[model samples]
Target: MKSSMHNPHLAPEKYGIMDGISECIVTTISSKGPNAAPMGIIKNSNGIKIRVFKGSKTYGNIMNFPFLAANVVYDPKIYTMTTFSNLERSQFDTIVYEDVEFPVLKDGISWMLFECNNLQKSSQSLVADLIPVKAKLSHIDAVRAPNRGFNSVLEACIHATRYQLTGSQKYLDLMQYHAEIIRKCGGKTEKEALDQLYRFMKTNK
Candidate 1:
């Protein structure tokens, strides 16, 4: 079953009201095509906020096209793929809202489409204020996954990307620490994700 809202000014509780940094895979369409990247979104009384760093494709896309989709997903591969490399078109299911195009992961549980209403720029990144104009719920699991090692894996991916961009050994050290946690506490899927990240870092270095 599919569920959607035309203009959900504020995020609905059913979408799991995000308090602080909620990790999501954001998709935006540019002149080139669909682009996906992992972002941390914060739900506030005004709307949602995301930090788009300078010199990244996602930052440029958001500047050119204000409309983007934030997908709530749990798959670790999706997180790693979008962060380290580009995902193929076949990896996403296209959806249109208000005549704007956006891609949603086939396995995404929910999505929120927003238009940038405000932008605060700093030296390194731009903080965008977004208004939720469209939302959809395709699948809702009865039980939420335990965060035994999932959060660590996600954090590790972020650090991995930082390591790639800045060539900082500190980020690599942190990534390695998180990988150890995933090895000891994570399930099969988490282990797979950790392995994928490790391989990417090794080859790229």
Candidate 2:
């Protein structure tokens, strides 16, 4: 069976419903060491728009330094570890890729530059401002595999934020994932925020 996205590189014979949306683990560095977060990139009339949350580290970094790499690689661990506090990996080391900056533990790929001109927020699908920038994809690792267990939970944080931000219709699309994490991992303000997100998503919806 030939995939609609015909690339000999992709493992499975049939690539299902991921027709256009490309998911990338966005790596950014601020005064705070590293932020390896998962983000969705969509093609627009002008170029690519990186959809991220306003309160996320990625958002903060971009605000400080507008330059960032939309790292397109093959690691679900990046997403899982980005949001989860339980991954036992080596500490991040500062590595430079661009003349500007580089992230730790990168998989090397070439010719994968997708210009990000649009910066969409997790709050509104179409309201975020689109910033123009030129970036180079220096490396590419293996093709990305499916996320599961804790990885799946971390992936849901993106969803959780959307539910957290909206003035209306928040819960129906976002509350379910955050609730799961809170029930499983109880703690301080995180638990409060998750519960608050749930309440907000509910009443606002």
Candidate 3:
């Protein structure tokens, strides 16, 4: 049987979490308050994994707290905004898991609570092989359709991040992919996204 909106590709949804897609929003409280950062979570034969950058607040939180609550969310625009602007929007949920206040998506259909069983640090990033202590879904209104807004933003951000490594090939590929989505879902749904990508390509070049 086909799983709802089953992606033909192995790498989950463009912006959100999907099977084989390793992503998480790192939220932790310091002496000040709470901070949220995006992370890439993975799954392998052994267990689940999370990758964090070196010298980042997310890195510090995972190190100090050593336990984290991961949420599978459906907001690609937020991810893009955070990645490009390094800012957190006001629309998110914070809950107490274990001894920490975990940031979650209020609209997400599910949530996972994991204890940091293994934490690996390196010169470039942090990789944690987590052990799932508890996990379940919080039923909401999520369906099996792709979020056009998130897809567009993710397409733009991924292109922006990979421009140097891939060069013109990446730019062309990204623009063309985005253009196709615009044609299908209609540009009205992705006006802001299109503008952002265009501005970056023009100014950054």
On lDDT, the leading prediction is: 1
Off by over 4 Å in 1: 1-10
**What lDDT tens digits, residue by residue, belong to model 1 across residues 1-205?**
1223436454555665387778888888788988889988887676668888998888998888777678888778788878887789887888776555577777788887777767788999999876677778877754675775788889899899889889988998998889888888888888998888888888888
Best by TM-score: 1
Candidate 3: clashing pairs of residues = 22-41, 23-41
Write the number of the candidate with greater TM-score, choosing between 1 and 2: 1
Residue 27 error for model 3, in Å?
3.1
Model 1 scores a TM of 0.89
Give each model's whole-structure lDDT.
0.79, 0.45, 0.58
| Residue 183, model 3, lDDT | 52
- The full ranking of all candidates by lDDT, starting with the best, is 1, 3, 2
Regions of candidate 2 where Cα sits further than 4 Å from its true position = 1-19, 85-98, 108-205
Looking at candidate 3, what is the lDDT of residue 16?
Answer: 37
Sorted on TM-score, best first, the list reads: 1, 3, 2
Per-residue lDDT of model 3, residues 24-65, tens digit only: 655554554456555666765555678777766767877776
